[model samples]
Target chain A: MEIFSNLADGFAVALTAQHLLLALLGCFLGTLMGALPGLGPANGVAILIPIAFTLGLGPVASLILLTSVYYGAMYGGRISSILLNIPGDEPAMMTCLDGHPMALHGKAGEALAISGIASFIGSFFATWGLVLIAPQLVKVALLFGPAEYFALFTMAFATLGGVTASNQAKSAFAAALGLGIAMIGSDSQTGSERFTFGHIHLYDGIDFLIAIVGLFAISEVLIFIEHHQGGAAAKSSAKIGKLIPDFCIFKRSIGTLVRSTIIGFLSGVLPGAGASLGSFLSYSVEKNTLDRENKTFGKGDPRGVIAPECGNNAAAGGALVPMLSLGVPGSGTTAVLLAVLLQLNITPGPLLFRNNPDIVWGLIAALFIANFMLLALNLPMVGLFTRVLLIPTRILMPVVAMISFVGIYGLTGSTFDVMLMVGFGFGGWLLRKLGVPLVPVILGILLGNEMEVNLRRALQISDGDWSIMVGSPLAIGIWAIAIAGFVLPIFFGKKVKNQMHADHSEVEMEEVIEGGD
Target chain B: MSDRIFGFFGLALSAFYFWATSIIPDSFMIDVVGPRAFPYIVGTVLAICALYILLRPDAEPDWPNLMNFIEIVFATAVMFLYAWTLSKVGFVIATVFATSYLTWRLGSKPLGSLITGIATSAGIYVVFHLILGLSLAKGPLGF
Candidate 1:
């Protein structure tokens, strides 16, 4: 009854014309942006935050628009992943495994429709789960303190080794580097310049959006110059089959969907776990469940596609749980949300639910609306996103380049930003060459500030006792799970791969981490 | 391995970073955490990665077309100039040159390239400045 009243009030806020229009506009732009290569959702959201701020949007309206865009991007990412074999981000990497092959087999439409419905199921189910499980999850999360946080951070650091495409030590080194960068400007506790090197820009910490754009967006352009021309959607045909997925096919994978949602949502709720993980775990879980069937999982298996799509989308929502209820972001995108909340002077956490019930509940309601709207938007438009290839690369590339430059300039009237974009582009090109995953860098930067704050705060409470991190059972359990997530890979990654192959013939194209994508 | 590229660049960059860090005056409240510690770590990592790459040239992927390198560098130069010129020379002239170079490289017809360069710049001007209400600089056309 209480929940019903809250949701009714939320409907009042969400149903307003202003919020609805913002949601529509956000979804429209997000799909369009995701349709484009070289610009993913995080950068899309980051670049548009200035515009959102300029519009003087209230917290609910701003979150509604931004979150809608997020859902749209998830929907749109499959367009490129299916038709062009370009995963928009790490989460979409799995989609391309089966989706691109399906496209190759003239089942592009089926793949898109399947993945689309799967995304809707994943997102819709997860949103419902959000309303139901969030308060309970928050109740559990409240028991964590700095000792627990420190332990969790350490486990996050450990898990990152498995999370990345490279050696764990290198990923850890990157984390340390990101932490070092976060320690720039001035140490909040010590009141001293750290790495400013006499440049005033160094006085302020690195703007995560700037670094992200540099790393993911600009870097993508630089690398695209090398291999982008050869295969840019060569002769991919569309499916003329049923636009909606057959329920019989879905019947086989409902377990994958439910299990994946649980796994994905849980991963998303954890401080450092992410959508890619949600999808990966979901795929693995589905594979284990189907082991007896001799199901060939990655050879355009519907379950293969279903698991990740469901997991990633559910993870997207689960990621928001921590961001909303705990003020801690479980992933890079949510961390960006945190930064936006901070900029707007909106405190996100348990108090947010209490103080601004409308914003919290309304934003939740908008996500439900977005999930449905994206399904409608995507079903009618899969062909349109694929048709983008009809625009000659000649015109498209230059226009995209011009728009990126113009966007940088318009957002910040500074020449340095453009140069910074180039520098990050170069660095990104090198990282790509080396096969290090780019998502981790963005994840690191997004969480970098929070990790630092939590570390310091933990120490303050424990009076510098490192043992405080796992002092509570909940914290200890998180630490154990995190350690298992990292260590299980060393012993079990190969075994899991072989078991997977023994059961399901075609192995998942070990996600091309470096350059091939 | 052309350590000349890695070695010279690595040593030079780290030297600069080290020198920059060395200048931070020692304080009475010195603790385990300091500004210099992080940079030194990154410099060390960069030096290590550079060394590994330099030592093992065989590990690098089969190089793409050699001419692609030249193209990439040239494009980077074009973008650098675009950044440099956008504010001073104004967006129009800078954009025209950037678009023309990018289009020609991407295999567009010259006439189409020229039209696109001018049209995109104009479209951007109207969309960003006129429509969005952010101030974009007017070129000599002064619209």
Candidate 2:
């Protein structure tokens, strides 16, 4: 099969000494970034993109490093949840329910070990899921004509704008805005200047690297300043508790791994639910199934730790499926990666299989290696990553800042880029304050061009018959999904929000009467 | 009134999209669709989202950081100066000055930031100019 030979070629690329070293370095750095609280895969990868670009690595090498960091963070996120009751990212939040309590019970070691094994189970299976399903999905993708692509990308944008999080719709908006800004220089279709504003530099459109760094990295720094006067301090704790688990612990929770992996992976593939939902679903499922054990699920149970850890890790892998095959990111992080891939001029979809086999296979292989490496390093290195929490914000920030500056210059040695970074960074800060999620903006920007090109192409074919979108099943299916993606969230999310508010109000009323008496 | 205004804008965008959707030039090679189709859809959706925001304004825009805005403007201004004077002032002076201003804004010590900025500019200049042997454009400001 072509897949095997292509995979072999990817292995040859991945196995080279330079790439091997890069992978290891990537895995190490990825864990370091992942361990940081509140900074998940998206922020972590976005922050260090400049470093990869500065180092002058090709696209393949860059993707491998970034992907490794993504998996590494999933590994490190568990330790924080277990030890500190602080999930490093959203996916790890469910682990905090049982994991932190278990640590207090002196089963921190067991909790951690179980989480490690569960994570390995989740990621391994998810990677294989990608391997088995990617080609088939690619086959399905080939059926999409431009009209279908147009409809699908619009749906992706709609989902991005609608979902993600409550904190920053502007982030997504900003991303799409940035994409539209990038489209300004020369029109790909008409070769006309749309928004050059008389600047010759505008002719080339905006660079994706510059926009990403300015928005994600620089804005992050401004945010840090607003929150911390002196930034996060470094903690280098050298204590490693229990690092390994015996068979008894393994036997007790193997079912949790299987169930959670499936739950996590499936929920993860959905556009809006994301990992938090996945982990929560997994935790409840484990509870319903094992309620008769006379054991508390959330109070310090190993299964509690296992379910979320497995679910979240598997979900990270599952989120990639839609992004890779359909060129639609189910979540914010994948949207950013989608932007990166498009910038490198790789058009993702069924044709990606026929072309760019090296990139597709190489990234896939790197992810497989990243999972195993994460498990191996996590147990022995928990103490070290925990210590990373204490790194002085003063020191880490300056170094990162300098790396960003140097990295931007590496691309065409452009001084003009510094201006763009600072501008977007400030805009990003403003957008954040407005409660706009930056992800959708980027998504809109990314899909804007795709949507535009497809619209033009589709119109040319249909001679301006507006019914082209509704006429075909493939287009109609995408349209239906797009509508569902938008409408379903509002219906269900509103019900949940109202119910939560109702419960809170009842609790408040009860407390008020008692206090008055 | 603000809500109504945003809603009207949303409606306007959607209408504009429908009108503009008709203007895409025909490329008859592919009989399925043309370039105008997606924009027509997105323009329409953006209008819909705009309407959603107008009808249900969950969150409004927040305030910008004043200090960051100042820093951003100064940073952009410095780049403009560099581009205009790159040949005149020479790469080293222009770069050093820009770097100094930025580092100072970034919270470096006045002296340290300036020294380091100059040092960084000079260091890069050395690598790019002397070692790599790229020639700096010598204009009014001589090297």
Judging by TM-score against the true structure, name the best candidate: 1
State TM-scores per candidate. 0.82, 0.80
RMSD of each: 5.1, 6.0
Over 4 Å off, model 1: A1-4, A35-39, A54-56, A81-89, A96-111, A161-164, A228-256, A270-273, A284-305, A327-348, A354-356, A458-517, B1-65, B137-143
DockQ versus reference, model 1 = 0.32
Q: Candidate 2 residues A1-517, lDDT tens each?
A: 8767777777876776766667787778877776776466777777666556555578888888887877777777777777766677767877887787677667777777788888888888988787777788888888888789878876775565334234222233344344445455656775555456678877787776677667777677666555442334334452445767766866877788889999988877776666666776787788789865746865677887888888988888888888888888877677767866775678777777678888888888888777877877777766677778775453344344444555565554666776677677777776666556677666666666776777777776778876776778989988888777766655565554454345234434544564588
* A312-424: candidate 1 lDDT, tens digit per residue: 88888887886777665656567567667765778776668778889888988999888888887788777777676445656666676676666666666778778777776
Candidate 2 Cα outliers beyond 4 Å, as residue runs: A1-9, A161-179, A229-240, A292-295, A494-517, B1-48, B59-143
**Looking at model 1, what is the TM-score of chain A?**
0.83
Docking verdict class for candidate 1: acceptable
Candidate 2 chain A lDDT trough over 10 residues, lowest sum:
A164-173
